[model samples]
Target: MDWQQILTNVAGEIIAPTTAAYALAAIGLNVHFGMTGLLNFGQAGFMLLGAYGYAIASIAGWPVWAAVLVALACAVVFALILGIPTLKLRGDYLAIVTIAAAEIIRMIGRSTSMTEVTGGNAGLAGDGFKGSFQELSPLPDGNFAIGPWSYSMNLSNSWWVRIVGWALVALACFLVWRWMNSPWGRVLKGIREDEDAVRSLGKNVYAYKMQALVLGGAIGAIAGIVYALPRAVQPDSMGRPMTFYVWTILLLGGAATVFGPVLGSILLWTTLMLVKTVLRDVIPATVLRSEQIEMLGWVLVGVTLMLLVIFRPQGILGDRKELAIDVR
Candidate 1:
C-alpha cells in the first residue's frame, strides 16, 4: 500500500471544495437542530432549491448577484412554506414532514414535466451555470499550489471557489457566533430547552422558530450553491443522502458550538477519503470490487458514527447539557 499517497489524498480532502460545502451545510443544520432545536429533516430541500434557483437564473441571463439572490429567496420561501403549519408540530411529526417535503422537492425536480427548466434527471449542466461564478474570479489564469496541493485559480474546483466557499463558512460562523450570544440567541436557547418556558416569558415561540428556519435555510441554500459550483445541480445527488451527510457532520462535530461543524466536516471527509483510498490500495480486487470498496467506506462511516454516539453522545465539542441530540 502506498501510505504516502493515501495520506496526501486524505490531506487534500481537508480543504476540498466539497468539504467546505459540507461544512457550511452542517453549520446551517447546526442553526436548525443545534441552536433552535427544530427537527428539520428536509434541509436538502433548501439546498436543492438554492442550487436549482441559482442555476436556472444564471442560465436565463442573470448576473451572479441576481442568481444568488434568487437562490436565497427560494430558500426563504421554502422555509416559510415548510415552517408555517409544520412548525406547530412536535417531534416525530415535524421530522416526518420535513423529510417528506425534501423528497417531494427532489421528485419534482427530476420529473419529466420540469425537463425544460430543471433539465429533469440530468439537471443543469455545470458548464452552463458555472461560467458566471467563474467569471467573477479576479485571479490571473494559472495554477496556484500551496504545500502538496494545487488547483487552477479560476476554473471549476479552483482556488476561487475554495476562497469564496471557505469565506462563506467563516462568515456564517461569525454570524452564528454573534446570534448565539445576543438576546435573540438566548430566546433561541430557551426555545431549544423549553418552548413553554420561553412562551411564559411572552416570547413568540413560533415567530422565533420561523426566523431560525429562514436563516438556517438561507445558509443551507448558499451551501447548495457552493456544492454546485464545481459540479452540476443534480436533484438526486442533493437529495436525502446529502441531508443525512450534513446531519452526520453536525452530530460528529458537536452541534451548538461555533467551529463544530467545520471540524466535523474536515474530519468526516478526511476519514472517508483515507478509508476509501486505503481500501483500494490494500484490498485485492478479487476480494472486493471497486463498488464494494465504496460501499464499505460508507459502512465504516456509519460504524464510526455509532461508536461516537455511544462513547460521546454530546460529540467532540458539545457539552452534555447543551447537547442537541436528545432534544425534547
Candidate 2:
C-alpha cells in the first residue's frame, strides 16, 4: 500500500541477486534456443544438477573451488547423457525428453531413499556449505548507501551475493557475445534456420547440437550454483515453472540478441514485482484472499506476455530475421 515501498520493490527486483541468477539461466537458454535453434525445455534439470552437486560436495567437505568444479562437471555429464540420445530426434522430441528429464531429476532429489544425501523433499541446508563462500565477503559488516540505493551488510545482508552475482552476469554476457560472433556460432544459427542445409554443407550438425547443449547446460549449472549460494538447494525450486520463467525472460528481451536475456530479465522482474506490489496494495483483502491476489498478479503477467507476442513476436530487442526458424 505504501507507494515508496512499492517503488523500492520494483527497483530492487532488477538489481536483486535472484534477478542475476535468472538472467544467467536466460543467457544459457539464449545459447540453446536463440543462437543454436535447439529446443531445450529442461534447463531446470541443469540447474538442479549444478545446485545439488555443489551442495553435496560441500556436505562432503569439499572446498569451494572443488564444489564448483563438481557442479559444472555434473551439468556437462547430464547434457551429454540427455543430448546423445535425443538430439538426433526430430519434431519436439528433444523438448519432451528434456522436460521429462528435468522432472526425473526433481523426483530423484525428492526420493525418500536419497534423504541423507539430497535431504529429500525438505532439501539441503546451506549452513554446512555457505561458510567458505561467506568468509570471502570483501565488504566490512556495516550499512552503506550508493546514491539512492541503501545496503546493509548486517541486516538483509545480500550485498556480497549481489556483487558476485552481477560480476558473473557481466562475464557470462561478454562470453556469450564473443562466442556468438565466431564461425562456430554461425553454424549454430544455420542449424537453427535450416539443419538440412547445414548438414548438406558437410557440417557435423549432431556434434554442433551436442556442443550447444553442453555449453548451455553448463551455463545453466553455473546459474544454479549462483542461485543456490543465496539460499537452500531445494528440488522444487528447479521445476518446470523455473524453466518457463527463464524462457519468458529470454523471449521478452529478444532471444537471439546478445544482451536480450539481461534486458529481458530486468524488465520481466521489474514488471512482475510492480504488478504484485500494485495488486497487493489496490485489491481489497475482503474481495480477494492473499493467495488469490498473488494469482491475479501472474494473470496480469500472462496477459502482458500475450499482448507482447501478438504485437511483436520478435520481442522487445529481437529482429524478425533472427526469429526465422524452420520448424520442420
Candidate 3:
C-alpha cells in the first residue's frame, strides 16, 4: 500500500471542491433540519434546478452573471412552490413531498422529451459558457505546487472551482451565523424546539418555516451549480444518494451549528477517500475484488455513522441539549 498517496488523497479532499459542494448543500440542510426543524428530503431537487438552470442559461447564450441569477431564481421559485403547499402540514408530509419532488426533478432531467434542453440522462455541458468566467482568473495560467499537491490555472482548472466553492461556503456560513444569531433566528430555534410555543408567542410559524426553506433551497442551488461546473450536469449526480450524503455531512459535523456543515463535509470526504484508497491497496484481489473493496469502504462509512448515532447522536459539534432530531 502506498501510504503516502493515501495520505495525500485524504489531505487534499479536506478542501476539495467536491467537499465544498457537499458542505454547501449540508449548510442548507442544517438550516432546514438542524435550526428550523424542517424535514426537507428534496434538497437534491434544488441542486438539480440550479445545475440545469445555469447550464441551460449558459448554453442559451446568457452571460455568467445572468446564468447565476437565473439559477438562484429557479431555486427560490421551487422553494415557494414546495413550501406554499406543504409547510402547513406536518413534518412527515414535507419530508415525503421533498423526497418525491427530488426524484421527480431527476426523472425530468432524464426524460427523453426534455433531452434537447436538459440533455436527458447525459446532461448539459457548459463548454463555451464558462469562457467569460475564466477570463477573470486572478492567478496566472500555470501549474503551481503547494507542498505535496499541485494546482493549475489551465482552461479546465479546478483552482477556479475551489476558489469559488470555498468562497461560497464561507459566505453562506457567515450569512447563516448572522441569521441564527439574530432575534429571527432565535424564533427559528423556538420553532424547532416547539412550534406550538412559538405560535403562542404570536410568531407566524408558517412564515418562518417558508423563509427557512427558501433560504436553504437557494444555498442548495448554489451547491448544485458548484458541482455541475466541474463537468456536465448529469441527472444521476443529484439523486437520492446525494441527498443522503448531504444529510450525512450535516450529521457528522453537528447539525444546527454554524460551522458544522463545513467541518463535517471535510471530515466525511477525507475519511471516505482515505479508507477507500487504503482498503484497495491492502485487500488482496484474490479474496475480494476492487469493486468489493470499494463497497466495503462504504459499508465502513455506514458503520461509522451508526456508531455516531448510537454513542453521540448530537454529532461532533452538536450539544446534547440542542439535539432535536425530531422535526415535530
Number of clashing residue pairs, candidate 2: 0
Candidate 2 per-residue C-alpha lDDT over 171-286 given as tens digits, one digit per residue, 9 for 90 to 100: 98998989889999999999988899999999999999999999999889989988887788999988999999999999889999988999999998899889988887788899
Q: Give Cα distance to truth, residue 37, candidate 1, Å.
A: 0.5
Give the clash total for candidate 3.
Answer: 0
Best by lDDT: 1
- lDDT of residue 110 for candidate 1: 99
Q: Candidate 2: minimum summed lDDT over ten consecutive residues — where?
A: 148-157
Per-residue lDDT tens digits for candidate 3, residues 135-171, read 7678788787788878776455468778888999999
Off by over 4 Å in 1: 324-328
Candidate order by decreasing TM-score: 1, 3, 2
Give per-residue CA lDDT, model 1, range 1-328, as digits (tens).
8788778889989878999999998999999989989888998999999999999999999999999999999999999999998999988899999999999999999999999999999999999999888888889999999987889999988999999999999999999999999999989999998899999999999999999999999999999999999889999999889999999999899989999999999999999998898899889999999999999999998999999989888888888877535633
Q: Candidate 2: which pairs clash?
A: none
* Candidate lDDT (C-alpha), each: 0.92, 0.88, 0.88
Residue 179 local lDDT, model 1: 95
- Winner on lDDT (1 vs 2): 1
Candidate 3 pairs with clashing backbones: none
